[model samples]
Target: MPKTLLDVDGLTVRFEVKRGSGWGKKSYLYAVDDISFEVKQGETLSIVGESGSGKTTAALAVARLVPAHSGTVMLDDGNVLEKQGEDLRQTRQKVQFIFQDPYSSLNPRKRADSIVREPLDNLSEKSEDEKTTIVAELFEAVGLRPEQMKLFPHQFSGGQRQRIGIARALATQPELIICDEPVSALDVAVQAQILNLLRKLQREYNLTYLFISHDLGVVQHMSDAIAVMYMGKIVEHADRISLFTSPRHPYTQALLSAVPTVDRTQRAKQKRILIPGDPPDPINLPKGCRFANRCPIAEAQCSQTEPELKDVGQGHKVACHLV
Candidate 1:
């Protein structure tokens, strides 16, 4: 097996919210609560959950874009959060981000090439000619024409803009790319194209990816491993085949049941597990299992005691009372 490229242990990110009046006490919002996972070299580990599940927050914390309240994010030989000054700058080059919306991510005034070259200019010590050559190569790698590089982001279609964003992410030549809902903003057709392009780039560059998305279908297509999160905590994690075939967690089973299969026969008979109740507020989370309120298999013990993630079979890990 390839060496682990990124190791995140007991990662937690909390936001403080005000409660009442003048001397209000701070309430903690656990955007990412004690989540731990690893991304191996050249592997894609996807984090899938509902909107408030903290997948994106976990990604940002790993990238050091957000302040982590606890835990460690180690990339290769160094702890990313511990670094300062030049070391931090260098660490950032090793990990890049691809935002969700191509339209909002790119600058409207800058040409496509300039936008792609921005990372190179900031992180690289290369000369002007070298930067230009590298940017052109990235554009080609992302399937964008050299001539189109001169065009502004506004001139391109939604799909084309996304291609430019991909080009920009590649410009840094990062070892790990955090794709936070990268294809969620694009049309269904365009989503496939972007996913394919990401796969191709990963093969060519031996890149590791932390792909964050709520869409299970996309996660199935792009991920080597899947980590299911609920209410700021990881509920299940396993290899792609095991996750899809024999999901151990009730939450994972519910998510898979909701995915639309192409087989009409199977689709017609499949029973969808409808989870009741809205997600609890992060600022005022329950003391026990965060997912207990909505989990169908949750018992009384689930409401009083939190379940620690335990390896059940092979490398499959689950944090639930039933598991």
Candidate 2:
């Protein structure tokens, strides 16, 4: 079996918000509430959910971009949340991020080569000659010409800017890459190109990814394992095949139903599962399951007590009272 590259346990992230005017009271907006998952070496584990479901925050915490309230993020057997100063800087060399927006992420002032070489400049001890050589290689690896390295961020198209982002992420030869909707901002045709490039790069570099996205179709293309998050909790987790073929959680089913199918027979068979009502206010969450109010088959028990994510059969785990 492949070694676990990233192990997250009971990860929780919250934001303090005022309850009323004039700072009447403070409450915690539980963005990520006791979520856990693992990403093996060379495998892609995707977290899928709707907007405000805390998927992005979870990824941010794992990357150490945002502060985690409670949890242990173990990357290559070291506790990331405990690292400080120089230790934290060193840890960053092993983990990199591909941001969602290519246009906003890249610096307009810097040339393409400079942008790609930034990570090596900050985290690597490579000499100038070595760095230049590595940057050239990265540009080529991401399908950009060596001459194009002189161009600014504005000179490139959306797809090319993302390629630059990919090259930058690869500069450190990171053990884990946290991709937050890397293709969502691009055109539909460009999204496919970028996704294919990412897969190709992963195979070549033996990269592990913690992917976050609301698009189930994109998750289906890239994920080896899938975790369905609803309102700051993981409701279902399983391998790609199991999750897609036999989703146990009502929330997971609703998500999968929205993905457009190309096959006529499959489209005819698939029915759209509509989830009613908006998610509960994060600062005033219910005592039980966070999704209880919206779950179609939620029982009294679902609202009375939160269900633990347990293995129903095989390796599939679900946190649903009905399941």
Per-residue lDDT tens digits for candidate 1, residues 22-106, read 4966678889999999999999999999998999999999988899999999898788979998989888889999999998999
lDDT of 2 by residue, 119-218 (tens): 9999989999999999999999999998899999999999999999999999999999999999999999999999999999999989999999988889
Candidate 1 vs. truth: CA RMSD? Answer: 1.1
lDDT of all the models against the reference? 0.91, 0.93
Best TM-score goes to which candidate?
2
Any idea what lDDT model 1 has?
0.91
Supply candidate 2's per-residue lDDT for 166: 94
- Given candidate 1, what's the lDDT at residue 70? 95
> By lDDT, who's the top model here?
2
Cα shift from native, residue 240, model 2 (Å)? 0.2
